[model samples]
Target chain A: MEPSDLAGMALIAVAGPEDALAFVSSGASSSAALEQEMNAVLNDSGVPRWPGLAAALLRWRPRLTDLAPERDLRVVERLGGQLLVPEDPEWPVALSELELNEPIALWVRGRALVIPEQKRCIALVGSRDSTSYGANVAMEMAATLVQRGFTIVSGGAYGIDAQAHRGAIGAATGRQFLPTLAIMAGGVDRFYPTGNEDLLRAVAENGAIVAEVPPGANPTRYRFLQRNRLIAALCEVTVVVEARWRSGALSTAHHADGLSRTVAAVPGSVYSANSAGCHRLLREGSAVCVTDAADVAELAGAPGTQLTPEQLGAPAVHDGLGVEDLMLLDALPLRSVTSVDKLTIVAGIGATAVLAGLGRLELLGLAERANSGWKRRC
Target chain B: MEPSDLAGMALIAVAGPEDALAFVSSGASSSAALEQEMNAVLNDSGVPRWPGLAAALLRWRPRLTDLAPERDLRVVERLGGQLLVPEDPEWPVALSELELNEPIALWVRGRALVIPEQKRCIALVGSRDSTSYGANVAMEMAATLVQRGFTIVSGGAYGIDAQAHRGAIGAATGRQFLPTLAIMAGGVDRFYPTGNEDLLRAVAENGAIVAEVPPGANPTRYRFLQRNRLIAALCEVTVVVEARWRSGALSTAHHADGLSRTVAAVPGSVYSANSAGCHRLLREGSAVCVTDAADVAELAGAPGTQLTPEQLGAPAVHDGLGVEDLMLLDALPLRSVTSVDKLTIVAGIGATAVLAGLGRLELLGLAERANSGWKRRC
Candidate 1:
């Protein structure tokens, strides 16, 4: 696209992501066409403007004359990044679920954002003040999911988010798919939290760092909230690893749930304040309880493709014993011997049944002959 | 009741609790009547014996001639205990939910087993090998529930069960209700695991220690499992505090679920094996996630009586702010100053809205005047 077209969309985008959608919905092809209609409305002359268009024009006109998208595009290009419009095939089709609230464009840095037709993207998010247990679970879950052919998405913030990104990048050795994607609230040109600069840069090298706003935009609080919708919209499942009783990650989870995507939460110590939000989610029936990667994969994978029953713990010695055997075993003396006749009376079985059960228990090494009768073996 | 009647019922009970029920169901008032019926069946005379009654009488016949109920009653009287039949008002009506499988009698050692008409009883059971986290939670939950006038029921074993008993006993000072009840697999006369003898004795003093079988009956493995059914049957809700991947407590929870009783499980660290059963319950949708005492009370209480929503954590600074105020607050810089005109453009609000929002933020101590413009307050 020419600099003029980039400037036209950027002018409308400067107001906010939603404003651009409104601009296009007005039947205006570009900012210039919208300006013509707005001017006509101002002079009380042309077809009536779309509802709320007049007020929106008032907000965007001030930004249109002052901003320079050519310079912003040049800045992103110099940083090896590209501006992605909704028309780009690289755009996540899942984001269409956002409907009218979808982002106008995505300013992406690093390798092209490739979400395949299978839509194997998952979002792992949590509190910035995560416990070591939460962080380890997040990292391990991310790595294992990546190994199983899923792309990880997260906010480029601290704690569980950073661990998730690191796990993805570290586990991407010799893998074919994009390792991870970090959706930033700030400009793609700058990683907001200085502490995670290296990790975010590594994320860009492996996959992409994306933002809805143009270059040099600050990561404002409102923008941070709006950014969550993007993460929720881009993924098929959102798993909250850990969160405080009140957290931004919860909002992200709610967003995913609102879009009818799968929402899963990892449960942690009931005593930990960091886990309270997760427990809250579980209590609300808003999220499935996830323990490990297989649980999440089952939630995100195609129907019936990954629906294997969870493996039970190692079997115990007496797991498969029959009813009479169990009854005879229960009646057997642990430290002293009891006669077979007494065992029959104690175990509520006949003498023949008791004798037969004792033979079975003896063969299984659960019972043994002691002195004149039977006793439980060590 | 006469000594002869006690002798007859005791003779039938020697075979098992079920045998007593079967004898009564056969229209035989006593063991002697049942013996006469069996003779008639053998001689091909009188009405055919009820379905399995012929086989059942064979199992009871040997024990009927050998046992003595009068002697058993004397031993219980010496121990200050009593034999409670289902016909007594003190019998828990909830056990009737077991239908055909209800225990025919309860040998109780403690304050009379008084499950009030309202049925304020809940079962808390878990693995004997419990973590400190599980123990603490179990104890706290028990104490709080006892204070709230609900009786706690648990298997008389170690770990989580003992802690629950202790919590209830300690918290029952000056309270009228029975603190806790221990449903034992063995006879109420003997607390099976000697390690918990002191605790069990205290429980009997405050609430009760009850068993289905007669005195001197060993707590066989089968009895332990059968004991779980009684626990589930005696309570309106069953909570598994912590359990292994395959635990007896889970069996109790499933039993409660099968009986249409509410089943709740406390959540814990995903990595802790002690919590695996609980997670499994949550995953299978068999149990609600319970954290604190209030949660258990709500589950056990009368519907709509204790339905208070959980209290949220302490409020944060940004809570309840309107959308425009949030936007304006987000536009304010941390260590830098910006004019109202720039704030209007960045926050995407009118200058008047920005000025009003700034004043509100200043009043809230979130923003303040900086030299020539506005910036965020510390």
Candidate 2:
């Protein structure tokens, strides 16, 4: 094993990310060097110990000595994933913003290209038991955002998170870009909530499944709470679709707020208990109310920046139409034919005006007469 | 006729509240005096014309000469209401806060006690075509506020406004105190939307029906918009229960914001088109999100100040019960008897604990045995 791999594995075995941060800040290059410095500090009465440093070193010394770096690497490789250390190019720089609380290392499954720059990612999260309103909104927002060249990041749970990934995958047709990521509370090798195994595998094929723990680790309640911080850290903006009071999604928003990232929430009915946390956040001035994708995009500072005509593989149409023609075209049915009477009512124009407008539209090849009524041409 | 009444009547006949304010602020207190001053201003090039003053005075000069204060007073008296000038003690001082746009006078029905001090009043306004959810919320909030010593103020329209007045009246039993005021766009004598005439009569008996225009005036679209300002100015806080885009309630909120008063909006489902304006207000930071009467009360600066036990005509009961006993008492049926199993489930307590709680509650005379189980005592 490489010396740096030995140091990373030893740090993970002995202590959490905070301990590794402390060791790095102390200018120690390896686990052996860190141990020597920590022991000297513990022995000297004159030296001031870092907070929790002495106890952490004492607790981790035996585990550090027993850690098998080679075996851990083999496990990660056998799972068809890679372990990313701080020095790796694929490591997200946004995680470093967590400072001492940053993950010691990330166990990642999927192509390395799936890791997005901090600015191109957005976190969409909400209640595990979301309402249909929430799920629809999450899916629509995720699809719209992915089509606009944004990669969605979220906890890989049921309801909103699953819908968000599904929406992004639906938008990823014929595209080489990574569109979504599922940040897991447990090891990526064994997808937690085995019901979502198929969905997670699909995500791994197109984007990534990421975790802070090693392979085969089971998810725990505490790990879920800790996992939220990584989602908040990875994205530039975190939007909560719906959450009941004191939901874990609120913890993610709080984390995003602590990170000075934009936090937004979609509002729901006051009668709905599911929307309580979002209303509380809006009431307390902790989160901005976002109603749609355009709202989220504008708040994230990328207004009107959707997929280009070239990216969409279609030339921009309808620009040459007059205002009245545009209105008539919009009122025309795209599938089933629409009668002129219906068009006039829908377009709020007189019958004579509608007939005239339809003629112009027909001349422009935007509309065509069917067996019974006028229809929009593809 | 009294000269002051002539001046007031002439101002009403000539122009709107804005013109009346200009004439009064010119330091001319009578019709003849104001006519002379306006003529002088029109004749002099040095004096600046108040924005539409010239055109208004010219347009109304003939009508002002033809005005009859005695006929107007008789009209007011015939309707069984009073015409209140600024000199009247019952005149709402909060309306004066509007400055140049304050009403020339108010046509008021019912006892004088209904007009509240600025700090003791809150305006509840919303879409005239409110949903059941909006109406329910408005009614509950109105009832809660009236019980807490606040006089509910609102427009006398259907939907949310009618429900607000109804809720306030429901809470006004046994108390001679007028707990509500319904502000009208037209005369209080002939309620517009004759469908609500019965509700208006009930409001006048228990509280007040007020209008900016004279008894014979019809409610025009412009007058409705103008009347919203009076509702906004007469209260300390204006809460919009539910509103569609471009609703008059939004105009009221804007007026409240212009006055630097607290503006709050109840959040509802984004799917409900009626809630669009309210969500817009929240997103634009023009209003805070309010879910219940407690939220409104706290924002209006009087929290937890509900009706006293004496005012409620009963000494407070169930205060001395243990937490579980109180919960069990609450779970007990008020009208019908409920079984112990139901109580246990409702209170989420063990059956044994529920039986013990029931014993304690019965001892306190809060609950009594019925044919099948226990019922709450009146």
lDDT of 2 by residue, A230-271 (tens): 999999889999987767899999999999999998888877
Error of 2 at B122 (Å): 1.8
The weakest ten consecutive residues by lDDT in model 2 chain B span: B1-10
Q: Candidate 1, clashing residue pairs?
A: none
Q: Residue B38 lDDT in model 1? A: 46
Q: What is the C-alpha lDDT profile of model 1 across B1-378, one tens digit per residue?
A: 111122233334344546654564454533556556444533442333332444344344445444667887887778888988877877778777775456777888787555543258888899999999999999999998888888889987899999999988989999887889898888777877999988888998898888888888778788888889889988888999999888989999988999999999999998888998899899888898888888777777644445323346667788989867988888899999999989877877656678889999999999999889999999
Give the Cα RMSD of candidate 1.
7.1
User: TM-score (chain A) of candidate 1?
Assistant: 0.81
True contacts kept of 1: 0.47
How well is each residue in B109-178 modelled by candidate 2, as lDDT tens digits?
A: 7765347788889899999999999999999999988888888899989999999999999998876667
Q: For all the predictions, what are the DockQ values?
A: 0.36, 0.11
**Residue A9 of candidate 2: its Cα lDDT?**
38
Winning candidate number (lDDT) = 1
The Cα RMSD in angstroms, rounded to one decimal, for candidate 2 relative to the true structure is 15.9
